[model samples]
Target: MAKAKKKSPSSIARNKIARRNYDFIETLEAGLVLVGTEVKSLRQGQISFNDGYINFKDGEAWLVGIHIAPYDHAGHLQHDPDRSRKLLLHDHEIIKLQAKSEQKGLTVIPVSLYFSNGKIKLQIALAKGKNVHSRKEELKRRDIAKDTARQLAKY
Candidate 1:
């Protein structure tokens, strides 16, 4: 009997740097606050998740600097591409994030966005930044691991 191939999540879309820059401590899904033109733009996949981040203000989560391109078909209702938008997380989750965020160096970062259950969703994370030296060390370790795997496959 032939085995079924497992489908990877990348079959959708992913932000590679979100994984590389910050260790994926945990992931949470929240509704993205969107305007009509922005939703249309997102459906067309004309959005940029780069340079996006989640931050807490007034005890609510907000996503900043993500670019949702203007809808091409919109005649005069263009939306801001680099707007700071609110993220809709549950009250309980928001409370948790508020507590965790107060600790030094802890931050909420936007991981990615995708459509689920026919609605757009944003994946956000709780993370601690990595220092430059640590980032370099992680790269070195990854290279060594790749080399080791290659050598083993040849045997």
Candidate 2:
């Protein structure tokens, strides 16, 4: 009898700016449609989340503004670095996301990208943008927590 292989998930890249700029309401994992060269680029950690966000069109979700750099050795057949890629999600999930995103100040954004069981997956979140004052308060809270932890450790 053949044994099933274990699936070891690995992280590729994260959108740190998304964490600092927004407050996440909910998060979900999603599949991505990518070509060979794009996958190679991702494996090389050649991706960026600058201005990236999820856009729904024709009842489908598309990943926009993310940049996957061309594979260094792909030559002339390389994929476009900035093309909008479709996200693979169930019909019900799409509907739910679309409805939630329609609310004012709520938006869908990609939080991170990784590989699971040899397939690439995206971690996306439904989030609301944080105001400057709220961001400042969050930073202050983090600093205070760190200080308290440090003081406790000293005793």
By lDDT, the best candidate is 2
* Candidate 1 lDDT tens digits, 84-105: 9998988899989878878888
Root-mean-square deviation of Cα positions for candidate 2 versus the true structure, in angstroms: 1.5
Candidate 2 clashing pairs, residues 3+ apart or interchain: none
- Candidate 2 per-residue lDDT, tens place, 1-155, comes to 99998877799999999999999999999999999999999999999999999999999999999999999999889899999999999999999999999999999999999999889999999999999999999999999999999999999
Best by TM-score: 2
Residue-level lDDT for 36 in candidate 2: 99
In angstroms, the error of model 1 at 120 is 0.5
Model 1 vs. true fold: TM? 0.84
